[model samples]
Target: MTQHPTKTPQFFLTSPSVCPYLPDQQERKVFTHLVGDRAPELNDLLTQGGFRRSANIAYRPACETCRACVSVRILAEEFAPSKNQKRVLKRNSDLVGTLYPAEPSSEQYDLFRDYLLARHAHGGMAEMSVLDYAMMVEDSFVDTRVIEYRRRGPDSFLTGEGEGELVAVALTDEMSDGLSMVYSFYDPKQEDRSLGTYLILDHVRRAREAGKPHVYLGYWVKGSRKMAYKIRFQPQEHLMPAGWERYQPD
Candidate 1:
């Protein structure tokens, strides 16, 4: 009989780069590769420790002087959508979300490109080619899935899928505790629908239905207006210096 030893993950630090969330600030990250059979377990552990996944890498902010990038997770079991969020849900009620294997489609790429151009035209992912997009969706080694949102067709009730044009797509990782939204993109033309808020609301419903406790919303940076949306999902816990504690804004 032969015995094998478990390998420990290796972590690396990134060089400082311009912080996208805050002006006149630099950002650094501590990251590790998430690969092999241990990927799912590793993902669960690292995510709970405040790391976020990109491709097969798990990373968390490691700023030397700033600790503003706080990790947030919604308490799905106790979440109550506010009036505006409820309106977002009602507005998107006609759409149906179907979970699919994490495989990229041309349709998804088209929507992704449109989203980048309209929303992040000068950001890092603006020049991403089709191959890059494919890698983003298909390079995962853990329990990942793609949820596509579209209009509910007549037969949607039977199949639990949607029909017509693809409205939005979410690349998600199903961890032991909750769902982690890796990335999502939608039709920029449908801005009136408030798809971004709708997406998180839908995830809250999903996490509760599946008996999951949290919906990891990644880093919520203080002073970043873009991140203000994350704080709205109340009764959430923030990963603090003392550990996960219910957030109470001062």
Candidate 2:
């Protein structure tokens, strides 16, 4: 019998780039590749330690002077939708989200392009081609799923799938503890429906139903208006320097 030694992951630091979440600030990250037979286990452990997965890489902020990117996870078991969130749920009640294997489709790409054009026209992913989008959805070594949102069909209950055009899409990773929302986008024309909030609310419901304790929401960067939506889903825990601690916003 041959015994193999466990391999330690090698991490590398990214070059400083202008912070996407903060003005006049630079951001750096330390990342490791999440590959091989240990990918799932490694993803779970790294995610618990504040790293977020992109493709097959696990990364966390490693800025030199700023410590604003705080990892957040919703306590799904104890979460209750607020009045506004409840309204969002009600507004999106006609829609159904069906979980599918992490495979990219032309329909999904169309929706993705529309979302980027309308919401993040000048952002990093604005120029992403179909191939890049495919890699984003398909290049994974961990447990990943794609949830597509669409209008409820007359036979939806029988098929467990919605009908018509794809209104929204969510790329998620199922970890040992909870679901991690990697990236999500929706029809910018349906802004009034608040599909973004509905997605998170639905995931919370899912996590509770599945007996999961928390739903990882990546990072909540302070002072970033884009990230402000995250803190609304309380009672969540923030990964502070002292470790994961409950956060109660006043």
Candidate 3:
């Protein structure tokens, strides 16, 4: 065997695991590290190429027989919140969002654990310990931020940060064209407000306010209700063979 450069990117495959979105299905992922010298630029390019980052690894669903994982990005300037989206906005009007460094707090971990236990009890991440949570939040080579969501207090208007308990959290990345929402979780108990959708909507606004052009919404797995909500944020773009293609949903 010939010696090779250690800097050359190496990819690895994860053993088959239970698929979270589909029942009786197994999922496998092929991933590579997104670190070293060019992480930020690599992240932006891979994002356009349909990859999402978890920790410092950039990956997409690499299922052999399935092509359900389609990457979705919102045309932030052209996006119009539907009536239902507006309703969600109205319902969550009392919540405030604050962006901070990618450092984990016990408060956040409590909400995260509760979100997993209450909402994804049987999910793989259900067993993630606080150390695991810290690794999730802190492992990154590119710019990443955690946006904390909380209910507004009576005096919040007078100050800025709210007083209510944390209700949602979005681990997001600031990209060249927009902000990519890597993952988001919310208080399942507040199901009526649709906090997840509200979080994405808030990111779109944040992207626009920051003068970004789109909001990368990771993967939209067909027939997965968990991923389907991504479509309603139109006019959106989907990665196509020819390149980014604008689409109108039925």
Q: How well does candidate 3 score on lDDT at residue 147?
A: 91
lDDT of 3 by residue, 176-230 (tens): 8899998788887888998988998999899989999999998888789877777
Query: Candidate 1, which segments miss by more than 4 Å at Cα?
Result: 1-6
- Backbone collisions counted per model: 0, 0, 0
Task: Evaluate all candidate structures by whole-model CA lDDT and list the values in order.
Answer: 0.92, 0.93, 0.85
Better of 2 and 3 by lDDT: 2
TM-score of each: 0.96, 0.96, 0.91
In the range 1-250, model 2's lDDT, one tens digit per residue, is: 1122327788999999999988899999999988777889999999999999988788999999999999999999999899999999999999999999999999999999999999899999999999998988888888899999999999999998999989999999998999999999999999899988999999999989999999999999888999999999989999988989999898
**RMSD to the hidden true structure, all candidates:** 3.3, 3.3, 3.6
Superposed by TM-score, candidate 1 places the C-alpha of residue 11 at a distance from the truth, in angstroms, of 0.7
